[model samples]
Target: MSVPVAPTPGSAPGAPPGAAAPGGGAPGAPPGARPPLLSRGRWDGVTTALRSPAVLALAPLTLIIAVFFLVPIFGMTTIAFAVQTDDGGTRIGLDNFLDLSSHSRAMRNSVLISVVGSLIAAVAGSITAFCIAQIKSERLDSVVAVFSSVLANDGGAPLAFSFIVTLGNTGIIFGLLGLEAIGFTLYSWQGLVAMYQYFLIPTMIMVTLPTFVGLRKEWTEANTSLGGSRLTFWRRVGIPIATPALLGGWILLFGSAFATYASAAVLIGSGGFPLIPLSIDSLLGSGLGAGGQSTAMALGVTMVVIAVVVLFFFNRLQRRSARWLQ
Candidate 1:
């Protein structure tokens, strides 16, 4: 059933295999004629992409993370169980865990600081989101949103320096206010809590802003029409619906504060009270100034475990809350 046309000019009979194709399009085509690729359908491109080696493009990034992130975690865990001999050789065992009293104190203080800061930030951020959502002017809301976005990720060494400039022992603001009569220490626990809120609130705002948009005003009106007080309605309905996003935001803030090193390291210094991160940096970097490296490694493993556990709960909260928010 094959009807034969004359062989193409460049694809003559008995030609070499790759010399040209029968259509004279791919390997060779008539002058001024369309190329084979232009004649192909859209599905061909999709199929080509699917079959391409480009799918493994992220392999390098994945390999880098495995080497840098997971390797260090595993190394830290291994070192926690290792001991140094008098002759300078290292042996591995459970000796580090045996004396975890000071480590426990540092872990507890770090958790306390992170939790308190995150909660304060989440509450403040939620209220700000609500206020922003209720704004009459879109321009104002946009400006505030842009400002919050900038502040959210600005908690680096510069932020710590700014705080120091504004509130340190010999701070400019303190001098202007003439508050030398009342004593204040910027390196104290309270100062850390306040400094944490500066960044954490913005983090919370970004995280929970979507939830504000998800909130339906009709639900509030309906609750009011049903004779429920605003407080009662918010406590029973609004808070329940928003719990997932709130908790998720709080967890984000907590993780950021917990892993903070530069700010604490810069402002508070190693001489400050042993927050877990500070302790780790001091023990390992300062060669156990008043602590051991194995202990620091053990604290690091403890943080990894805590992060995993908290994220597990945050994910569950998200799934539950997404039922309404989505």
Candidate 2:
């Protein structure tokens, strides 16, 4: 019916104004109208590309882990379960594990040593870290960090030898201060724990230093502004934020001490020490006994399982701690 409409501005030469485009909504379509297929396809392609960077970045690490870690673990697990025959043949069975049960004392000793040493390291390290954080000198912090890293990595034969010459019976401390007179011997489980502290405490300090440093002055000021005492601030705010990191560091220290071999072996020979690592060594070289490579592999497998669980909890705790740090 029949009013003539003026040609819409910028309309196609021969097309009516307000008409739909060839493949989509009208050029002047409402905001909610679907985009053209080409545009949509472009966005889909962009979304796909966005998902690829993380995968690509992680590819090398994943390949290395599969080849080194997973492959070794698979071989070890198979060996752990394989029984050796009198005729020098191997067959899949649980004989190694069954034999390992007899070494429960070694397991218990290892757990006790690791747990106690790590706990001591955790407390000592946390205190040290807290003190270090309070100091405003970046130079001092860097020095301490460098020393800690060096000491943490310093283990094995040289460390064992140093401990012996310095703390052993008739060693330097004994000669100078007569520490032996005090009935202290660097050859017992107590000595092992002491040796662990030389490394574990340094490790704990490194792990905890960052968390303590991240405790901003504003946070303390905020708590004080709320009429909280220093004690109250730590009780409510500081401890809560740092707890996850502390626990995670402690677990890491425990794992380190648990898996240690060379230092313990050198300081206290496998024949004397009943720790799992020492037991593994003894079993592996036993030659003509039930304690052989298979049993050693079984112990190794047990350690691997424990390490997996420890790492899982450590990662979870680290995630929680990271949230607060950020």
Candidate 3:
């Protein structure tokens, strides 16, 4: 007399309920012991996607940039080259680019402010960042860091407004120093440089503080043990290791000043400063509106290109600068 065998859960479906799966497990292997290859692959993929710290951290930023920054860059670049046909149909052409050359003075001024302001800011801010990095008191460091954060973002209207009050003719600082007697005004190129440094310094400081803090004391001690003076160590090891960070901060400041609109606009309102942002705003507002829209878009596209270039520089610098630090 024989009884029929039942296949176990791990067996082939067609096998007896309690019988072994001939191609796979034994007579009574646990159902959960090993999933099929396809199922395992899917689970592994899901777990990897979930557990990756880099993906988790960058996902939100990537989404935001894709939606906001990249989409707008495409739209703006399209508008820059768009031309209206006789029947009002739009097509891409070089008319806007030809006209963009007419904005040379504004371009020159924008670059001038950005370059000069960045240099001053990078130098001044690095000095301040070095000082901040050296403070042994965590509380004092926190307070200074808070102040730097406030100033770095204290751009636009508030900054311009404060400068106006202090640097304007009737304001307290101006009245006290009588800057007007020596012929000073906050509406000219020189004044704009000063005004731009207000934000640029803090921006540089914010970017540079980390580099200063990352400089290891052991390296300096090693340099000194090698018979290098403090000045020699700084001039050679310290500065060489830090050049990338400083240069990155400078480029950042330049981009900030170049794209700045509100502060410059407010400070030089109706003063005919040939800044790119002001020209764009004016073109959008004045009787030139219809004719200059494309040119304004062209300027915008230029700014986007510049910003992307700066970002590329920072990334490349980080990779290469690692060797110097090591």
Top candidate (TM-score): 2
lDDT of 2 by residue, 61-117 (tens): 767777788778888899899887899998888888898778999998999999999
Q: Which stretch of 10 consecutive residues in model 1 shows the poorest summed lDDT?
A: 1-10
Candidate 2 local Cα displacement, residue 259, angstroms:
0.7
Q: Rank the candidates by lDDT, best first.
A: 2, 3, 1
The TM-scores of all predictions, comma-separated, are 0.72, 0.75, 0.74
Q: What is the lDDT of candidate 3?
A: 0.75
Q: Model 3, clash count? A: 7
Q: Write the number of the candidate with greater TM-score, choosing between 2 and 3.
A: 2
Residue 9, candidate 3: how far off, in angstroms?
32
Instruction: Give all candidates' CA lDDT scores.
Output: 0.72, 0.80, 0.75
lDDT string for model 1 (235-309, tens) is 988889888888887887888878877787788888756788888787788675443878888878877777887
Model 3 lDDT tens row, 97-136: 7787888988898898889888999999999989888875
Over all chains combined, what TM-score does candidate 1 have? 0.72
**Model 1 ranges with Cα > 4 A deviation:** 1-56, 83-93, 136-146, 178-182, 224-232, 288-291
The candidate 2 region of ten consecutive residues with least summed lDDT is: 1-10
